[model samples]
Target: MANARNLSTSSEPLNPKTFLSSIFDAAVAAADAKLTIRGHLPQKPKGRTVVVGAGKGAAQMAVAFEKAWDGPIDGLVITRYGYSAPTERIEIVESAHPVPDEAGLMGSRRLLEKVAGLTDDDLVVALICGGGSALLPSPAPGISLADEIAVNQALLASGAPIAAMNTIRKHISTIKGGRLAAVAWPAKVVSLVVSDIPGDNLALVASGPTVPDTGSRADALAAIAAYGMKFPDAVMAHINSRAATAPDPADEKFARNEVYLIASASVSLEAAAADSRRQGIEAVILSDALEGEAREVGSVHAAIAREVATRNRPFTKPVLILSGGETTVTLRAKGKGGRNSEFLLAFAIGIDGLNGINALAADTDGIDGSESNAGAFCDGSTVARMRAVGVDAKAMLAGNNAWTAFKAVGDLFVTGPTGTNVNDLRAILVR
Candidate 1:
């Protein structure tokens, strides 16, 4: 991996917005496939090298692998629509995310076919990341694509954590869990993952397409039941069928397989912290594994920031409080916003115009929920500025319309598709 020191640091006399952006960029850079993947790439195989993957970062990882590889490599990878990276050898296909589509279904079937005939000498390099669960959709037999999409929509709005959502996903899909790796049995499989889950659980990342699934069908059904997810009869039946069981962990086929976390939320959080210190800011990483309701987490962080800004109990001024991990947003209003936006709005309300505090909350993949904006930003002036415009911050948050509120206030942070995903990056600058 490239040294974090080589990354660009925040300029002197730190401007909050610029400094925060720099920190985010550093975090994303630290997780970029081009920089971290080559070191983890396995030795070239004597037989054909087949690459297959699906995620927001899969296309980018494919590009990196193609560039670094010496032998002839051919494969297909699916990425979120508009998140495709330029690549020569590997085929990159665009597909829907957070919901499955026909494109993903076709691509996933083709990916499985590509590795089906591979021999023990052949190599299967699987690039997996945050959105793969939805990007590589192969509905289990007897389940329709529409049925799978409905289940996914319910899971997303159910406010379930990524792990739970993925558990349900793996049980209903033919490609997720350990099924994908099982199909490529006898061929050496190497999975390179960019983790976007809390605790970096290999089985939860992208629903563990290339690793053994530790979760059981009962676990998946329990998640569905917990979320009160109503799936079609066919979908439910498929989940209950014997075919739904994933490959067992003790399977010898997986003995030759390897899973490597090329980048993760913790690594990116540390990179952000390192950059902050370089700028002479006291950096404290609260947690890289935080998980909870978005608004609730935001309120708690706001309290911490408020104390630091006013009492300076935890740290002195010019402190950057950082955290990484995924947060959930339960849908109450039919509002157009993601977890990050919701978090920022709640945070803004919690701070309530306390001065000298600025913050940024964003998904590292450059998309928050289903919105175009990566996330939103707020400083001391946010609440007052919204009030000045006759906008009720509380009402907007109540309606779960943080994106619209942030858009009205011109505070949306828009970094187009950052070819990676390490979950969320949140920073509060106390000055």
Candidate 2:
């Protein structure tokens, strides 16, 4: 990967927004939207092919499936409000994201009703993706959608990782934990997945609606305890009751169920790297499975960039270091900013100056967290800029106010919605 010292800054030209958009476009291209989950569809069934899903990518997947399938197809999908894609046949519903709302709960109920009466001759295509867990929120008996929303908000603010959050969600949800597929018993289930989780664990992605879940209600309670969040007695009782239910049991009904990860973070990263190469920038993807605390990863990347800048070790200059995967932020700040902004802010503090480094951090889905910003950007002079503005970068980092800080410096990248979610992408350009 290129180091900071190797990047040549000139009076020629540079557009931070355009460069970041290019990298994101490459990442999306790598996901291969044309494939979707349709490639895994089984032969035409005697019954109908009902497509049901929930996530940021569900609508897009619906569009892909519509074009690929030649047989009878009808169903509904749920996505975050304003994240909807243009769809002709399948019903696409929008609802609150990151927090389950009345609309999401109703949508989940309708989805369940849609597939409940299917027979062995029918097929159920589940387009699962990131944010589905929140987008398909159906609280179990004794749990209310209001309570679920409260817990979800708390969990998100607690900084629990996506996997842990989904574990809790699966247990609390009536449709998750493979219950959706189980309800469609006798009907063949094909789960087409676009992974947002770091390890691409199908069960954790979208709470494993069609895929079997290895987690249990106990796991959900444990996650709640791990985060020290308070819940109502009814909520606690619901978790206790689910202890009797084994999430993933071997059953004759499940024999026809299958889950496949058709698209992933690595795919997006490789596409970005290829794009960089095409742009005359040598790019190397560090890994597609990178995971950890967001700020810590930022520090590590900054250190590597420093090494390349000062000593040309491990890798020389003029190459872009790229990586994909989900990195989480344990929210300690009341300020606005997503993981991408936090990562960039941390990287900026580490690099400070020494010239010739430019980097971009963004969520492939476009919206970072609940914020409108895709992510944030940093250059060699970022530190100087912060200092000149009389803003204490360290203090902002402490408050988890990287978004506010970046916005103050006009470095936040807001792309609205990119209509995809392959996790996080980082591009470190070393001079």
RMSD of each: 2.8, 3.3
Name the 10 consecutive residues with the lowest summed lDDT in model 1.
1-10
Cα error, candidate 2, residue 411 (Å) = 1.2
User: What TM-score goes with each of the models?
Assistant: 0.96, 0.93
Residue 277 displacement (Å), model 1: 0.8
Q: How many backbone clashes does candidate 1 have?
A: 0
Model 2 spans > 4 angstroms off: 1-17, 35-38, 243-246
TM-score of decoy 2: 0.93
Q: Per-residue lDDT for 422 in model 1?
A: 97
Q: Could you give candidate 2's per-residue lDDT for residues 93-119 as a string of tens digits?
A: 998888888999899999999899888
User: Per-residue lDDT of 312-409 in model 1, one digit per residue for the tens?
Assistant: 86887778999989999888899889999999999999898698899999999999988899998998789888888888888988888899888888
RMSD from true fold, candidate 2: 3.3
* Model 1 steric clash pairs: none
